[model samples]
Target chain A: MPEQPVPRTGASGVIHDLGYRPYDGPRNGSGTIASALFLSGFRNAFGLGRSGKSKVLPFLLLALNLLPAVIIVGAMTLFNANELPLGYARYASATQILVSIFVAAQAPVLFSRDLRHGSIALYLARPLSSAAYAVARWAALLAATLVFLLVPIVALYVGAVLAELDFSEQTEEAAKAALLAVLLALMLTGISGLIASVSVRRGFAVVATIAVLLLGNGVVTAVQGISDEQGELRVGEVAGLFSPYSLYRGGTSALTDELFLTPPTGAVMTAAYFAVMVLVGIAGLAGIVLRYRRIAGR
Target chain B: MEQVIRTRGLTKDYGSVLALDDLSLDIGPGITGLVGANGAGKSTLIKVLLGLVPPSSGEATVLGLDVIRDAAAIRARVGYLPEHDCLPPDVSASDFVVHLGMMSGLPRVAARERAAEVLRHVGLAEERYRPMGGYSTGMKQRAKLAQALAHDPRLVLLDEPTNGLDPAARDDMLGLVQRVGQDFGFSVLVTSHLLGELERVSDNVVILDSGRLLRASQTRDFLDATGTLLVEVIGADAQTRMGHALAAAGVPVQARGGLLALDPAPELGLDVHDLIRDTAFDLGVGLVRIQADHRRIEDVFADA
Candidate 1:
């Protein structure tokens, strides 16, 4: 950074006045403010504008998340496989833990730090309203999470096309996976963001988010696995509704031709899964807005 | 002058506790000081002005805009430095201020330029690129002030700008605040529990006590000469000798904190200044100083 001109000092060693230039430029409204906040929050999720230590965790997780896709692509190219080995939608399911960890680790960075450090007051004291602040942050996290979910899928899609696979089929599958990723990103951002906002403590927020995303998914997966063994498909399908990852899986199974251990069967079950998942996501975002409103009011 | 802030019967009641009680006041431009002890509703009043907290039974207008109806407009034109810590630890002060400047609706280039200017004004030019997590309390406070000023609002409300600072740093912060209001052409409403600090920079002073307005007047009024002279003599038992001599000489002199205090009475037909000088000379003591004692903001609370 270039050095700013130091205030001149006089004979008595007193600092002279460096004129404070008033801003006579055009100022944008709240919409611009909210978009600026959204962009900043998006950068914060991956530690782009933060300290060196903060960058380590998010990038490490991103690298870990992308590793499997790279290995699968290499294997496909080396073997000259006629079919794409990994399903685009199934890739997220296979790497669900990485996604869960990323969301759990990063949600607090976006949602909790401001509240925890009392910096939310600075933001609220601006032209932006508390609800707008919350929504902007939520949208930023949604965008970042979408990036995380889409990168591997895009990598795989590129690999499939490069390896002489059917372009249209690959495009159709990637588009479907992208749609499911949006839905999944919406729900994940909401759940983790809400938990981080309410909990305040970063560690507790991370643990709670992981519990809601990973542990809940694990239990549901176990129940689904057991029900599959018992030929009780309905029990497994209903249990899948309890976790975001399971909801994503049910979404993937319903929207795409991907096979699942216990997929929600029929049009009604699939529609119900989609509705509940979207509702939960909306509710979480609402909770975050309400939480910030309360803080701003205080 | 038009009122920068006008509050009419402004009351903020938190169940079982009243933060502000039927307060009515009009504050014009220049640096006005809000004085109150802890829990004296100083913070509450700022919050209400900023529209972060709503008044329960009254109304307020900041910059002639209704606090409720035009809160967004008020916020756009008014800056606020919250009493609490508000800087993010991880981000550099430059980045944080620019981001907040944008959040205040400044364009990107304007935000960046304004952030740098304000940071420099607050004496954080070199350290602006450093993460605030490593900053000293004074540096953090400066950074906070920088962000508040980044958008060049017409008015800035600073809550206890000198809080948690050593005497030197506190003086620097107060100096910065004074320049912000006077040289920079921004109206300021700064709050402090330390009455003396505000008296130096504030054009007007508003004192609050137990959720009620204790006093609101020009800083000069709170600091008006109380018609008493403080006498300080440099000698052995100077205060005792002066007290006895003044009392014997028909002057009602009282010793207070190593100084003799006396009120001049016309009826006595004695030149008080000459008497003090003569007494000190006769006693072989050096007259260190003699000056009028002024009433401080603390005296307002005492009088109340």
Candidate 2:
């Protein structure tokens, strides 16, 4: 190695005065800002723009969610089955934990990171108001979570169609699956977005999301087991409303009572369940927006 | 000159602690230096002007927008560089600045273009692609300044841009700030606790003491020469000999603060300066620099 000259510790540096010009060009409004934030948030949810380590959990959970559908579709083709035993909605319910894990891992990437790093200040100080910023983030998380939860269901439908199954039944089930997927997205985004916004640490937000979705379901199930049915409403069905993921699954199962082993929750009871779930989800979502509004632009 | 900022009875409090107290003042358009010790309402004033914090009582306006009723509008036109470390560690500077630019209502293409221009203006160049976590304090400050300019704001509030920088880096940052306000034509409100750091860069100075306004005026006003003259003679014993002769001449002279002072009274004669010059020559001492010795800007805070 060549020896370097001893450098002066303190010396003056010259910088040319290449001043900046003011921007007089056309500028977009809050809608465009929100859209930009949405796109950025969506990419962040999947760790697309982040380091390799950040992508690990999101991709791993996504692959895990799809692997079961691939196996089921392959088995159906191999066995010359005319109908799928696992319906699309039931398939999502059966693998609800993977979808929940995806939400847990990715929601923090969208919500907790900016809050933790204090970059929310930069966001709020722009044309984007706190409410708009919150909505954009929620939309991104919702869209990403929906894609994660519904892609396998789509794959299931496509596989069944390619395998020469009953096309009419498959199409009907696909529509039902799409509706359920949207509901599941709403529930996950509302709850996970709330958790991530409040818990600024990514690890803590992820753990909180998982605990709320999974452990909360377990607690509700235990409660239902202890409580004897009071009337026509089943204890298990009523208890599922208390947890978001179970609520989605239970609602889907009730809607497709003929296709599954679980007894149908009456139409009225199911509507009430949905009403309660939406209110709860909306409350948590409102909390996320309020959390940002309180500190937004500060 | 247009008034860039105005505050009337702007009081802010946090429970029992008062951050700003009845701070009524108007700042004209130029580079205004905000000086105060820590906890002296410097940051609070900036926050109030930016509409980030609501005043407990009072009215304020920035760029013709009310601080309360038009906070969103005020924020739209105002750029703020917070005092604390607010950069995210994961993202590169280019990505971060572009994201902020888009937030400021610039389209994606325009944000990208403006981000590049401002980053170059701040001297970041190719280093803009590097993650901000690895940047030095000076580099990080420049990155912050670049984002502030990303939206082409009418005015910028920079809270201690020279904080935690070395001497050379501080000078560079100060020079950049001066040129930005002067050449770039952006009204600037820069804050520092160091008394005279903004002397060369700022056109106006506003000093705050313990949550109250101490002084606010043109920088040169506080530093203007007092009518008295300071005469410095060359030699080891020059000051002493000059002092004695001037005292004998009854010119009301004394060695005050290392300079021989002469009262510039009219009755002394029109050529009192010439008399002093003659006295220095007769005493066989060379007269060096004879000039007005003005009171330093720090003198105002010395009492406070």
Candidate 3:
């Protein structure tokens, strides 16, 4: 066998053989679709499915949210079989509030890690555009948050059906609760994910997410509480469009069988609020992605 | 004759700080060494080529695709090994590489196979299944290299691959890097601040200082000799006496190590062999070694 040549370390050998070539494999679909799907898979594989540390708190929050539903059923079955409690709806409302808080707190970790670690550089070097990167990250956050919000809500609905015992009535009530939970979860996840993407630091992202979730509601509540007018339309319906928590509260209230506060006068206003809030959240997320891309480039 | 990465007046700014100055460069394939001190914008240039960061000014193309317009296309074909420790602590090297490979468009089965092959190649097969958090610095660097190669990219951008490693580990990593570019035929752009080290492995060297190109040339040119003789011998007061002897004999000599370094003086028509042998015979000292001192590129830079 011929003796192999030793590898050259200096530039003389390298300059003549600048061996870079463009990839000639399957182009696929302009990269956006593939990148989005990959990001989704990455988030799913790692976020909810991988670690005990990541999953525990979210699951615990879900369990806490469902605690009231379990308590309500237990009280009706084991304690009071005749009439429902005076403030049964209020306990359900509290569940929505708790889920909102949990989602807001966790969303920052999803967006901040990629930026801090420079892994985002690796991803962008692929055929994925900044827009696609943003969408994928946002999708991951939404999906993870949805897992936290949906599981307990579904458990509560199933528990509610078993508690009712009357098959026909149970089916109708369970369907209604499921629909309400899905809508609430979507609103919460979208808003939290948007807030989280606004900054690269986890601390800032978390603070911004929580501010949108809690302060937005507080502002609306303060406006409603001080107003002396009768049938004054709660800003929670309109201003809630600015915050995920408010949107969830308003949507849940609308879906409930009992009318806790007078229903917003028009369904159109509620629909408009949801639509506007979602668009704003998405736009905010887009801004964040563009800013990050610029920063990373530098 | 293909340019893997070409840039024209590429610039990047961070607030008031210019991270990358107006840089015009042509990066061809194979293992091209990018050498610069810390804060010379090596990382910035790599990030821009990857299309992770948009330039403040100028244009660049990687793998024949416009860096800005065809970023995703470029990224899909390129692999990157970052300088810092960024692996997820909870995931095993095999799992992470496989996941990244799949994300780059390989099917699940293919990704797994590629991940196994890459991990084995990087000498991490025994520990591939272990979580990265427990890995030593060498192991972590190997794991990072494994992930970058897992997708079977056409080119790899390695940022200080030998960073945070012992001398033996650094040599091993450099050897692996050379193999990846030569044996596997993938183009590599590897960065380092240690010029001499890269001169041992890189075929081409691009030197940068303060975000400006100092020199870009073949490694041989940088290490070529300037025709100066270095003489070493064993005796009492070797360098000092030899220097005095050479000076008295009308030859210029400088004391270096255990040797008397002689500058090339054309006018004297000096015979280095005769002079050394005669000096050793007269002094009754054994001659050890006498050879020309090959000037390194860094030495040239220092002279400049």
Candidate 4:
């Protein structure tokens, strides 16, 4: 083997040739690749490993999201209320603008940047399939959204515990809220990730996601208000099915003490609400996979 | 000879375009240059070999693994550096390579070690920690090369490794590729449209034209000296004088870029080298040198 001298910097610097050693060690399979992608993608959503400037938006949104929860806890202690002021399930519903903005702003960080920069080609060239890449990215977004939704619930639970509220009641409500948060996170990740993946431009993706989420919610809220005024309970409930937030509200109202303006009342409507939620989530995930498969094929 | 890549009438067709048209090849282990112009199906062939694109018909195998049925297995053993930009701008080369090494099945710690080694091998050790967005074109290509080698595969397919580099950097990159094949014990199938760039590094050459196999041969065969001599002389008007004198003496003489081309006539049994020497001595000019003219890869393309 030829020894090429390494470039010298300082006089004290030492160099070694350590000739190339072939790696015959054991290698993990596609499962490991997908998991690594998931881990990296999860960190990226919160701007971890990214520039400090990039970290500001997601974290600022999180701080704002938690601000109301902290105040509710403080207010509960000061007023000596018999119970927590915000129901566990209703916390996300009331402060959903922050949640919507968080998912909208961060989804592109995980999805749009890779496709825009053509780095997804690197992942597809590995042992991992394009479907696995899409699924891993969606999983990362879902996990991040879950963290966003769960932090406030935990804070509220701590506050309620210290306030000496009924332990069993608070536990059940927190558990139910946790379950609903999972479902909500699934749907949010699916929708936002799909939008971000479809549009390669980051700014365009963020705006489109915000439009789909907030515009859809705004129109549904208007319909629910008019329908409630008209005393058409069926119209209001059906309009609630049109938006993800409304669906979550309908679920919490049906399953918790919090009341929504138009909750899915009957067994049939309630089942449809839950079914649609899961279906949209699944469909959005499937769309992202198909999109990536097309890119890989090209 | 054991083959590193083999294809039996492989073909790929997009309804409007046929990317690979009935190409059959046997590429043995070593450094082989896949040469073609932009639309000559080099990238398509690399994709098929890596199992990213399935063939419309026929068969191909890499490292003896079927391209269709055992695509994932083939991918595990073969590394690919795509022709286009494939790096994430925000991630450092170290992190990107380490992550890709893990993606190739190495555990985290092993991946890190391998990444460091490969980055240094590619001469990116000093700049490995900087974000790729701030990298020079040469640095970016080196980082890409580092990731491809991080997994230590048996074969590496490099698509235009020196695409945007200046001449000096291109020379360095080609030298590294030669080392990868000779010193590092990896079979390489590198592609380039520039004909002469691969001549110095490749053991064999394959030329493609409009999705068709144009030629494949040993690089030495393409560079073999033909039965002609290139004569150079010193002094003003010496070349014109030599051309006239040779032609007058019934030798087929031509001027090729300031060098006098002499096709000796064996029928007359004239010693052309001796004649040129005496002519130069008689003309009061100096004979610089007389050497055989060898064909270049560019000549092969021009002949086609």
Candidate 5:
């Protein structure tokens, strides 16, 4: 016996006959982990890796500044000396310069891509909030920068210990160096992430980030130079509070004279400067996140 | 069934240009085709419903959640496939979908499982692990569809799902969309400028013209059968002579190509089929076909 032919219906008729069902299930922790992993994979797919082209220039800039530190470490070990080599202060300055460049270049692209490509809609569609998204991207930036900074620091630390130097002071110095690296990474990452979130265009974001980081200190320095003939220690400390670069200089100067510009008069002043700079960075980042949420909510 | 979307005077402006002008609409469950040409406010409506853009005026709710006040709540249960190609090209379809599922508050294992299930449903099982950059256009669309489904939302807003696809691919995408609404039981608000295409898959269609609501009705109402007949006959001059004979037999006729179009009035005691058959028999012409001409939505606006 032959099978019966199916009856024909209008286009809408076939859809009605299908009897499709909606999906209903529990959303739990497993979902969040999967989503973060997916976002990470997506970022990596777009050539956002540590060694990708987007990061090559910044990495090279960092490597150039760290080269002198590498040589100074070798020289100190060869001479069996406790002090850093000549011009090590300038090398530290170079490290700060490289960090500024890195932050300026990366912040805009990280924040603007979603807005430019219309992927922000897809992102907001998920259970994620703008604050969470901002935090995740900032964390990624900080982690990447830490790898760049820590690799050279670790090489120098191990080289110093292997030289059979005074064991007691060496451990303390190493811990200081690690703490300094964390402070620098956090300062740069937070500032850049905040500025990047201010706009949807990469070029504008980079310009704004750079202007804030570089020009902000210049304005403070000029104000101090004209107002105080005595190079007051308090003014320098106050300036450091306004800028991450200044704060980093003040912090590192306490550990090594190569940080240039004399250290703060007291530990309290240094701590206050560090606290204020970090707070400012956080506030800037928070403002950007709020603005992004407003624009994206549309 | 509950209404999936409801909007009142929803408006949006881009600088001075009003993208969505005082639009109000209600869309129920199942497939609704939001039909409009490019720049005709279709995308604006979808964006407003998804809570991605703030409306300049008015209010809206999706799944009974206020679009502005409950944006996060609305987003939690709504899925969206944007019109543009925004997928990260370097990521595999499975990984991307899984990540999105997790971001939507799913557990890791469950997100992975749901990702696989959605990819398979969209016919991307074999290539699910390959980078989306290497996938074909059809595959990319499927990957986008998979991500939207991975979270198991109550409704999915698909903007121009068939935008760049060829006829065969368009048909395939349309089929998947219909199945998504049917098999998954998710309400679908899909958009397109092609009236004929959506007529095939949409249960209801809302037409927008120049940022204004033109019409909204069930698909059948827009595609109602007109009381007119299209009669075709064989042999040379068949339409010309048939037109005269239909007139002599007191039947309204107009010659259109090889067919004589007749306006059938029920009270006139006119049997359109018999009039054509008997007229053809008398004229010694072979009757080829007789069919009713259904008026399409496009025809309703042709004069305008």
Candidate 6:
């Protein structure tokens, strides 16, 4: 065999022998690669590894998402109301618009940039399988959105605690809020990630996501406004099952109505609400995974 | 005798447009340059090998692993530098490369170390921290190359790596590719549209035209020697005088503008080269240079 230019030290400085060395080291499997993508996608969502300009929108939106809870909690402190001024689950519903905007604006940063610039090739050309890549990215977006949604709930919980509210109920509400917020983030990231994956233009993806999310609210409200059954609107309640905010509220209302001043709704409505929420969340996530698999193949 | 990459009846179609047409190749280990014109399916071939795109109707293996059955396994071992611009502009080269390193299954410490090593190897020592958005085209290309090498792939597929560089940077990139193959001992399949650019670095050259294999041969073989010699002698009207003398001495000679072509029959055994030297010495025409007439890579197009 001809002498290869593998590195061998001489008496003097090393010669022009080797520019790169073959890695005999153990290659981490798909799990590590998937975790890496998860970390990268998570950082990208918050613009951590990106430029200062790219950092602006997500941070601003996060601050805005938490602002309402801060203010309401602060007001509760000022009022000296012994009972918790605002409920945990209600915070998600009340600030759903902020969460929606955050998901819409940031999902593009996480998903569309890779598709638009063709950087998906870089991610796919590794140990990570296409499904792993998709799932990791979805996990990142879900986690990021959860952070956006949960921080405010925590702030509200802390504020309510500081306001001298009963501790036991607050803990339960906080736990419920955490669970429902996670569920809500999963649903939003699923739909938004799917949309952003396909839309090559970042602007178009942002608009499309906002439109889809906000349109849910508009459609749910309009359906509620138009359909009145005798004295109550079962159609409105059923339509509320379609919107994430309503589904979450409806599900949480089934377990406890501390967040809502009114009584818990019927068990039949609760079952349908919980069923549809979990179903759509799961189906949407599967669709997103399959979408990325197809995209990676392309 | 082990083929680094082998494909049989490989075909790919993007909907109605066919990118590869029954292409088959068995490339050995070395710097093999994939040369073709625009839309000649060079990029598609790399994509197929890397399993980025599946073959519509064929079979292929890279590093001896089946393309379809072991795509993830193949990708884990092969690095890809895509043809078009694919770098994320906002991320700094260091951070981007480190992240890509981890994606290739390197531990965080290993990834960071590899990122720095590759960035330095690609000549981006200090400026690797700057955002790629602020980088020039050449810088972006270097950064892209760094990421491809960051994982220490056994083989790297570089598609049009010097696409937008000026002459100097192009030469630099070609030199780096040569080093990667020779010094690093990694198999390289670097693609380019310009046939001439691969002449120096490529041990083997594969030329594709219109989605079909036009030529596949060793670079040295591709440059077929005409069994002729380019003879140039000093002094005015020297080529004419030498040609006449060579012909009179029973040698077949042709004047090539200012030079003389000495293509002699081997069966003659007349020692024509020595005879010409002696004759030139006698005439005092001063043989300036005598070299084998080699085929230029551009000559391939003339066949088409």
Which candidate gets the maximum DockQ versus the true structure? Answer: 1
lDDT string, candidate 1, B1-304, tens digits: 8999999999999999999999999999999999898999999999999988999998999999998888899999888898999887878899898988998999999999999888888989777888899999999999989988989999999998899999999999999999999999899999999998999999999988888998899999888898899999876486787789888988888878888889776778878899888998888788889999888778787777
The DockQ score of candidate 2 comes to 0.45
- What DockQ, between 0 and 1, does each candidate earn? 0.76, 0.45, 0.26, 0.67, 0.36, 0.57
Q: What is the per-residue lDDT of model 3 for residues B205-290, given as tens digits with 9 covering 90 to 100?
A: 99888888888888888888778888888764765676787778877788876677888776678786798789878877777888
Residue lDDT tens for model 4, B1-304: 8899999999999889999999999999999999999999999999999888999999999999999898888888888898899888888999999988998889999999999999989999667998999999999999999989999999999999999999999999999999999999999999999989999999999999988999999999999988899999875498888788878888898888878888757876878778888888887777889999888999997788
Candidates' C-alpha lDDT: 0.91, 0.83, 0.71, 0.91, 0.74, 0.83
Native-referenced Cα lDDT, model 6:
0.83
DockQ of 3: 0.26
CAPRI grade, predicted model 1: medium
Better by lDDT, candidate 3 or 2:
2
Span of ten consecutive residues with least summed lDDT in model 4 chain A: A8-17
lDDT of 4 by residue, A180-220 (tens): 99989989999999999999998898898888888999999
Q: How close to the true structure is residue A177 of candidate 4, measured as C-alpha lDDT?
A: 98
Q: Report the Cα lDDT for candidate 1.
A: 0.91
TM-score of each: 0.94, 0.88, 0.81, 0.94, 0.79, 0.88
Stretches of candidate 2 exceeding 4 Å from the true structure: A1-18, A224-233, A258-264, B13-15, B227-291
Descending-DockQ candidate ranking: 1, 4, 6, 2, 5, 3
Q: In model 2, what is the error at residue A43, expressed in angstroms?
A: 1.2
Candidate no. 4 TM-score: 0.94
True contacts kept of each: 0.95, 0.66, 0.34, 0.72, 0.60, 0.77
* Tens digit per residue, CA lDDT, model 5, B1-304: 6778998988898887889888888899999998888899998888788777789899999999988788767777888898888776656788778878877777668788888888878889778887777888899889889888888889999999998998999999999999888878889999998888888888999999888888888999988888789988886577778888888887778877767788876666867787678888998987889988888878756845
After best superposition, candidate 3 residue A94: deviation in angstroms? 3.2
- lDDT of residue B179 for candidate 1: 94
Candidate 5 lDDT, A139-240, residue by residue in tens:
667766666566666666666677776666666666666676777778777777776766777788778877887787677656555435576756755655
